[model samples]
Target: MSSSAFKSSERKLEAQVKLNDYFQEFHEKFVETKQAFQVFKTKSFFYPDPDFIRTFTKSIKQIESEVKEMGGSLSRLIGNQLGTHTQKTVLNSMEDVKPESHVLHTVSDELTSEHADVLVKGTETESITPPVSEAGNDDEVLGSALVQEGNVKVVDVKKKLSSSEKKRGRKKFLGDNAVIPKRPRRSLMDEYVTAQNKMKSISEEPSTKEQEAEYEVQTIMDFKKSQGQYFYKVSWRGYSVEDNSWEPSSNLTGCEDLLLEFYKSRLKQQERTKTDDLNYQVMPHDANHQHILHKALFSHINNPTQKDYENSITLLASPKPPVLKSQKEIAELADKALSQKKKDRFYSVAKTLVENMIMKELTGKREKQLAELRTWERNMNSICSDPAKLAVENFVDLELPPMDFVYINECIAGEGVTIPSDPVVGCECTDCFTDHKSCCPNQMNSWFAYNKLGRLKVSLGTPIYECNKRCKCGPSCLNRVVQKGRNVGLSIFRTTNGRGWGVKAMENIKKDSLVTEYVGEIITSEEAERRGKIYDAQGCTYLFDLDYDKGDQNLYTIDAAKCGNVSHFINHSCDPNLLVFNVWVDCLDPDLPRLALFAAHDIKKGEELTFDYNSGLNSKQMAGRLPAQLTEQKEEGCFTPEKRKESRSELILKTPKGNRGLQYVLNVSIFHNVYQ
Candidate 1:
C-alpha cells in the first residue's frame, strides 16, 4: 500500500477505537442506571424518585449526543470504503460483520452482577449493527454489535417492530435507533433539541407558579394618577426592584397605612411654593385627610389627659415627622380650596412651615431622649463588674427614655418605709456549704441554698440567706452572688407586640442562676394601697407587696415604677422562666428582704426573660392576696394572666405601665453556696 493509503487506514482505525471507547462508557452508564432502578423497584412499590429519573435522563441525553457523533463518523467511514467497493460487496461484508467480544469484556470488567451476566449472555446470541443512515437506500442494511455483560438484551437496529411487540414493555434496545430517533437527516438534530426544551419547560412550570404565588407587597414605593384612577408602585418582599409592579389602589385594601405613608412622603417632597395650589393635597382622598386630622387632633389636644399625653409622646418619637395642623385650620383650608374650585385658590403656606418647625422641635427632643437612654445604659453597666454587656434596641416606636425612673441596683427606703442599716452577723467558715457551722444557712436554720456549681440547690419557694457585708467570706464567696448583681449579658428590646419594653437573655443561662434583683423603692403596705389605686387608674403598677410572712397584714412593698433596676423593664409571661425568692443579704430585717430573680430553667440566648406577675396565684388566691385595686382591675378585664398563653411571650394586658401591681411569697432569684 502507498504511504497516503496506510495513513488513512491508521486514522480510520483510531476513529474506530475512539468510537468503541465511547460506546463502552455509554454501556456502563446504562448498566448502572438499570441497577439503580432495580434497587428502587425493590424498595418502593411505586416509580423511582423524580430526581433520579431526571439525572438518568440527563445521562441518556449526553450518550445520545455522543452516539449521533459516532454515527456520523461511522457513516463517513462506510462511504469512504464504498468508493472502492461495489454496493453488493458492501452489503455482503455487513452481513458477515460479527459482534465485538472486547466491548463486552470491557463492560464485564467494570460491572459484576447477575444483571451483567444476563446482558453478556444475550449479546452472545445477537449480532451488533452499525446504524443505517437516512440517505442510504431502504434495502441497504448496515450492521455491527455491542456484545456485553448485563440483563440488557439487544435486537436488530433496523428491525421493524409490530404494534403489539411495541406495547409489551418500555425496554430500550442499545443502538443508534434508541439514541437518535429515525427522521429526515435534515431535521434530526432539531427534533432532539426540541425534546430537551419541552422537558425543561415541564420541569420549570411549577416553580414559575410558586414565584407568582409568593409575590407579596413589602411596601408602597410610589403612586401616580392615571385617567383619574390611582396606581401605587409596590415593592415585593424577598425580591428586587426589578420585580416591582404598579397595582391599582383597589388591589391594596389592607395596606392603607402604607398608602398613607407614601402620600405623606409625596407631600413632603412637594415644592414649598406649591402650597397655594388648590391641587396641593396631603392625601388622595377626603377620608385619609380626615384620618390624619383626627390623629393630629387626638395626639395634641389642649388640656390633654394622661393617655393623650402618652399618645403625643409616641407620635413625637415617630421616625417620620408629624404634620400637625389644627382641625379648624384644616376645615377652613378645605372649604376655601373647595369654594374656589372654578378659580385659583389662595391657601396660606404657613401650615407647612409650622409642620416643619414642630417636626424639628420633636426631632431634637427625641435625640436628647435617646442620648439619655444611652447614658443610662452606660451608667448601669459601669456599676457592674460582670463580663456580660447590656444593649438597648428600640425599632418599634419612638418611646422616650422613661421619665423619673431611677436605675437602682439595691432597694432604697421610701417615705414611711425603713430598711435596717445594721450589717448582719458574718460567717467565718472557709466553705459555707461544706462547713455548715456558723454559715449563713445555719444562721437561717435552713439547708445551704446552693450546690457546688453555684446554682440554687433549694426548691423553688425556698428563702435564700447570703453572706452579708460583715461576712468574713471574701467577694469571691459563692454565697455572695445576689449581692454581686447580674453577671449575664442582657438586652432591653422594644417588643413589636403592644407589650412595650422587654428584656431578653443575651447569653445562655443555666437553670437556678442569679439573674438580677428586683430593686426598687421599699414602701410600706399602706403606701402601696394608695399608690396601687393611682397606678390602676393610670393603667400601670410597680408595687410588689412583700407578703413573705403569709399574714393578712402585709407590712412592706417594693414599688419599682419610678425607681428600679433592669428588672423594671422585664415583662410578664404565662409560662415564666424567672422565679422570685426572698433573699436576705446586708440587712437581716425580715420585713425588708431583697427580691431576687433567678432562672427557673435553662434559658436559651435571645429568649425573652419573664416572671409571673401574678406570683403563681390561683384565681381564688389572687382575689384575696392581691391588692384591692388589682382585684378590681382584674374584675374589669385589665389584669387577666389566666387568659394569656406562654406562646405569646409577653402577657397581653391592657396597661401602658408595665408592672403587675404586686409580688407575693413564692418568687425570684438563685442562691449559691459560699466561696470563702
Candidate 2:
C-alpha cells in the first residue's frame, strides 16, 4: 500500500514546484536587471555621474548574478517536464560556432555582455524548439543541462559527452593566443632567454597632463624606472590588482595624494623598527637547537598532580563527551568477531569488544605521541640539533661548578706561551702499520704500536713521532696516533678524592691510547717564571714545561691554568694511569711541540684518568726547560727495598728523620701501581 501511494505521488509530481517558485521570482528580477544595464551603459559610462554610475553598476551585477543562478535552478527544477525544450536549446547553441580570435574580458564586461545578450537573445530562445517531428530521436537531444561559475546560458554543446562532463559545464572556446595556465611553467626564464619576450613593459605610460579624461591611477605598490624615466607600480581605482602597471610619474599625477601617503606609511614602518624599545624584540633564534628547544617545550608533559595541570588542556577537554571514533571501532570489531568461524577460535563478541576498546585507548595515545615526535625529528634543523656541530665552548655556570679558567678551542697567546714556527719531519713509509721500519719509527722509535683502529698495543716510555702531511704513506699510519685527535669517549667530572676535578675513561681505553691534547697558551720561560710566583700566591698551577728535548732555543710552557681542552681538567696523581708524551706532527718544531697524554695502562671504564704533572721530566726527557717549582718539593725522596729495614728503624717512633722512609714507601707504592 505504501509503494502504491509513492507511485501515485510520482505521477502527480511535487518538490520541484518550490524550486520553480524560487526561480520564477528570481527570473522577474533578472529581466528587470537586463533592461536597466542597457540604459546605464549608454548613459552612466559616458556621462559624469560618479555616484549614479557606481549604484547603476552594482544593481546590474546583482541582478545578472540572480538570473544566471535562476537559469541553472530552473533547468534542474523543471527536469523531464522541459526536456524537449532544453534539448532544442542545446542543439541551437551547438549551431552557434565560436570565433577564432582570442578575447580577454574582465568580470564586469563579461557580466554586462551576458545581460545585453539576454535582452537581445530573448526572441531567438523560442525559435530554438526542436521541430515536433524530430522530438522522437534519441541521439539529437540533451535531457540534462549545465551551468558555469553562475554563467547560465546555452552557449555551447558537445555531443557524446558523459553526464559528469555535461554537469561540469563548458569553457570558453579560446584561440592559440589565449594564455591558459595548463601545466606549471617550469621556467619563465627559459622563455625570456629569447629576444622576442624581452618586452618594454612601460615604454610609454598614459600621461594625465596629455589625456586627463582617460588617465587613471589610484595608488603605488612599488617604484621603478622605465626607459630612464621614474615610474610607479600603480593600481587603478576601479580595476583589479592584476591590472596594476608601471606608470610614469606624469601618468600618476591624478593619484599624487595616495602616492604621498604610501611613502609616509613606509617611513613610519621603518621608524618603528629603529625605535630603541623595539630594536631588540625577541624572535626565534636562527640556530636549530633553539627551535628544537621551543618545540620540546611546547610538547612537555604536564603531570596531573602539578600545579599547572589544574588548568591542563587535556583535563579541560575531558568533560566533553569522548569522540565516538573509538566506540565505533570497538563495535565494528564485535560484529567482525561475531561473524568469525567457530573453528578459527575467534574471541567472543564481549571479549573482542572489550579488548578492542582497551587497545584503542592504549594505541591511540601512543600513535599520537609517536606521530608528534616523528614530526619534531623531521623538522629539526641540521645546524642546531647536532651537538657536534654546535660550537658551545663555554659551559653554563648553573649546570657546571665554577672553573677558574676560560673556555677555548685552540691555544691563545699569554705571558709565557709563544706559538711555534719550525720545520717538519716527513715519512717515506708506504704503510706504517704493516712495516715497522717506517721513517717515523726510525726517527723516534715510535712509542706506541697501534692496530688499524689506532689503539695502542703496548705502552712504551718513548717520544711519539707521527707522519706529517708531506708523508706519502697516507692517514692510516700506525705512528700517526696523537695528531688524529681524541676518538675514545671520556668525561670530565668533579672528584670525591682530595683531587678537585679529574677526567674519567667513559670507555675501556687501551694502554698508550692518545687521550687528548694538553691544549693551552704557550708562554716563554721568562713568563713561566713570573707566573709561577703568582700561582704560588694563588695555591694553584696549570703550567707544564716542554722539557722533552731539554733546553731548546725556545723554552716554552703550556699554561692551561686559565683556558684549555678536556686535558686541562686532568688532576695530578702519583699513581696515574695516563702518561704525558711530546707528540710531534704538522711541524717537527722541537721547541714548542704539542703535549699529548696517553694511557700508561689499560684503563677500565669509569676509572679516573690522571698523569704525573709536578713530577720532574726524567728518563729520556731533556732537563733545564722548567721554571722554579712552586710545587712542594720533598726534602727526602723514596728509598730502595734494601734500605727499607734500616729506614724503618728511624721511622718507628714518628721522628722527623722517619718522614723520609714514609715518603719513600708512598713513592714506591705509586711506582708499583703505575707500572702494574
Per-candidate TM-scores read: 0.40, 0.33
Per TM-score, the best of the predicted structures is: 1
lDDT by residue for model 2 (150-214), tens:
33355332266564553343244343344332211011111112211111221133321243354
Candidate 2 CA-lDDT value: 0.45
lDDT of each: 0.55, 0.45
Candidate 1, residues 108-170, lDDT tens digits: the string is 233323222222211112111133241233222223232223222443435656655643421
Candidate 1 deviant stretches above 4 angstroms: 1-372, 382-387, 617-676
Instruction: Rate residue 25 of model 2 by lDDT.
Output: 44
Candidates' RMSD to native: 27.1, 26.3
Q: TM-score for candidate 1, please give it.
A: 0.40
Q: Count backbone overlaps in model 1.
A: 22
